[model samples]
Target: MLQMPDFLTLGHVTRDLHSDGSFSLGGTVTFAALTAYHLGLAAAIVSRADQQLIPELSRYLPNIELQIQPSPQSTTFANQYREGFRTQYLHARAESLEISDVPVQWREAPIVLLGPLAQELSPDIVSLFPRRPGTILAATPQGWLRRWDADGRVWPTPWMEAERILPQIDVLILSHDDLLPFADGNRRDADAILHRWSMHVPLLVATDGRHGATLFRHGQTQRFPAYPIDEVDPTGAGDVFAAAFLTHLHKHGDPEQAIDFANCTASFSVEQPGIAGIPTTEKVLQRMNEKKNLTT
Candidate 1:
């Protein structure tokens, strides 16, 4: 019998194309599962991808268990970064994930991250996990808020199912870029939007790259600063932060410490390209202590 994983993430494993004809395996599941694993959790993934990706994924996530739903093509993205902003183009998409794709035994996983890329997961999928204490259901809703044109240029769309999904999740994590369509690039408007969602969700986090993250809970809000670092690639930092936060929160139940640990962990992710920069628990704590000593 297979033992249940401590962390489980459902999404589509993506192929991220770079300039000069290079590509790497990426997606919320890729980064999040790795973060959980590095933090010493038994992480597993339920994702859709082409069979060819299996070898590459196995190389990156050697110890993590993967339940892949075979697809004709893997979801692909080409990202252009200019002056700290990113413009993404969608090239191809894999199959969508249904609740049935999840393994029956994995439903009771203590930490669940619903990370849909390209809106390939239905909102109803949240019902798979029971809503109760000790089980954390967290989501990064960027995929649901996205819509692409015939030309493959990706843009943000309103998350119409927020009302149904917000109340069901224990935590919600999204980037400032994810709020652009609704907030019109204003931070205040973005905070207002987060405030509205916070009323339904127990914990809400909006991460601003470099500027750090803000937490909304218990009718109050707090901002946590990012660990300063020169970034090489910012591709999966938010996903890393989300996974690290969820894992730490599950173990310690302290939102502030979780955010601090998440910020440190995500800072390491950006120092290298793709998943190469994800740090071990030892490195994360070393940096955290370094930051603490510098402040003191």
Candidate 2:
């Protein structure tokens, strides 16, 4: 019998090229799956990538089960950061994922994260799983909100399927940057849009890098501050946050504590490059305690 995973993520695994001519495994599913694994869950990934990336994924995520749809090439990205702002380029894209790509047994996963990258996953992919009590379906919709020009320069595009997708999920996680294109960089406008979307989903979270995150629930909003840390690389921090929040929420059923744990997890992620910075549960709890001590 195939063992059902505790946490499952669907999307594309990316090959991220760095300025120093180095490359590493990336993508929202990559980070989120690793985060769940490190947090002591039996995590699995459903992604589309080239066969070459299979070995790399195995090395990084030793215990996690990977259901990969073979593609000629993996999704590829190059990021240029100038003065704390990042401009991204998409060089190659892998094959798109369909409902058929997901395993039958995995469909019953209690926790599912739709972590699309390069728009490889369609909005209808949400229907692949059964929605029942105690099941948490969360999405990090960054990929759906992105578009690239002829030169493959990536830019934000509105989430055109929000009306169709929002009501189907339990939690929605997105970054402030993801909202900027929709709100035209207007804070109030972004909050308005968030408020509107929050009504459809049970929980809505918007992460602002370093500054912290805001949570929307029961038609009310609460802000959670990011844990302070000297940064090394911010790549995959939002994905890390979403995974941590969902994992904690699934186990403890407390959004407030989940966000605090997520904030601490994300803080640790930025202190190192790639998934090396993702913290263990003990480390996150230690950081949480230290923060409480300072405040007390």
Candidate 3:
């Protein structure tokens, strides 16, 4: 068995298609894991990967190990834009990954980030992460709110098992729009919303598009303004943010620094298209130092 890396992110693996006909490999775990690897962390991706795609993905990223569940085919997705909104369609059913697929050695990883896409990261997956010392859990709730119709149409569906999963999360990241439907419009202020959510978990974060993000922890809250950028595509920016945030925590253990690092990292992601736009840590730091907000 391969030794467990320091950080492991679990989620779906998909090929993304933008409206411009640009196609690239995507999904939160894919981009997030890569960001962690680039930011000086030992990173691995536990995904639902098929035999066919695994061989190819391995070739592109040989250094990054994949703890993939055996599937008949990889999960395939195509997204298009209507105005600034996005519409998604699922092209294939990926093999659902189970706790049994997790390697014994992987439990040694100090941090585990759950990057759910589709319905891949279910209650079963939440229960699988070892609840022990030195291991932290982070989750993005987008995966829980997604649903597909018989016609293959995809959209946000209101179903959050967060209350059940809260104890497992050391940090929970999500956008205001992602959970608004499930939040029942009862949340008036963003901070208030976070407070309500954190009643179950100590650390909760609610992200707002272009307005930056807010973090609530132990009765304290920290807010960061989203860096201004001409958005070429906002596709994987959230995942990029999560990846950088978690990487900083793994290395520095300071929430403030982690949020700033993540803000800079995500600022760099939206200036390009899909995964092709993901900038290196040096590139992000350079732009941050230069303070040049280049819009693509």
Candidate 4:
């Protein structure tokens, strides 16, 4: 029997392409799996992608266990950015992940990160895991909130299953970018929607890339400011943050402490690129200590 990993991520691992034709391995599954490993968790991934790309993905992920379903083509994304405006295109998509994809032993994983990138996770996933007392079910619902045109241009859409899904999730993490379609770039509108959703999600986090993130739980809200860092690429910072926060919350059960750890960890992710940017637990602790020293 396969040993249960501490963190189990379900999603479609993607190939991120640049306009110049160079591509890198990306997706929440790729970023979150590596982040969990660096944070000292035994991580595993349930994803769908082209069989040939497995070796390449493994090269970046190293020792993490991969339970992949072979697809004719891996989900592919091309991101174009100009003057801070970003446009995304979906080149291909993998199959949806069903509850049956989870291994029996892995069902009780202490932390399960549902990070669908292309609406590839089944809605039934909310009830698939045994809700053991302290288990954490953290979801990044961008996939469910997305809509793509016939030409494959991706855009944000309302999450139709929010009522059914939010009540089941322990922690819900989303970025301002994910909520843009509904909020129409208005901060007040975003906060209004977040306030409404917070009622259902026990802990709801809305991340704003540099300004920081807000945590809403049980009818109250708290803010944590972001750490300043020279950014090389902001690619997987959100994934890193979500993984660190969920793992820390599982171990510590303190949202404030978890958010601080996540903020510090994600700051380092933007300093570099891809897996190279993920900070080790030791590095994260060291930075945290340094911050404490400056204040005292």
Winning candidate number (lDDT)? 1
Return the TM-score for candidate 2, rounded to 2 decimals: 0.97
State in Å the error of residue 256, model 1. 0.8
TM for every model, in the order presented, reads: 0.97, 0.97, 0.88, 0.97
> Could you tell me which 10 consecutive residues in candidate 2 have the lowest summed lDDT?
52-61
- lDDT tens readout by residue for model 4, 1-296: 79999999999999999778878889998899999999999999998888888768778679899888788999999977889888899999988887888898888899999999989987898788745687998899888988899999998889988878888888999897677679888888888888888999889988888988999986688999988889898998999999999989999999999999999999999999786889999999999999989889
Error of 2 at 283 (Å): 0.7
Any runs in candidate 2 off by more than 4 Å, and if so which?
A: none
lDDT, residue 153, candidate 3: 76
Candidate 2: clashing pairs of residues: none
Question: Local error of candidate 1 at 157, Å?
Answer: 0.3
* Candidate 1, 202-266: lDDT as tens digits: 99988999999999995589999999999898889999999999999999999999999999999
Q: Provide the overall lDDT of each model, using Cα atoms, as 2-decimal numbers.
A: 0.92, 0.91, 0.77, 0.89
Candidate 4's C-alpha lDDT? 0.89
Cα lDDT of candidate 3 equals: 0.77
Candidate 3 segments whose C-alpha is farther than 4 A from its true place = 18-22, 183-193, 218-220, 290-296
lDDT of 1: 0.92
TM-score of 3: 0.88
Clashes (N, CA, C under 3 Å) per candidate: 0, 0, 2, 0
Write down the worst ten-residue block by lDDT for model 3: 182-191
| Rank ordering of all candidates by TM-score, starting from the highest | 4, 2, 1, 3
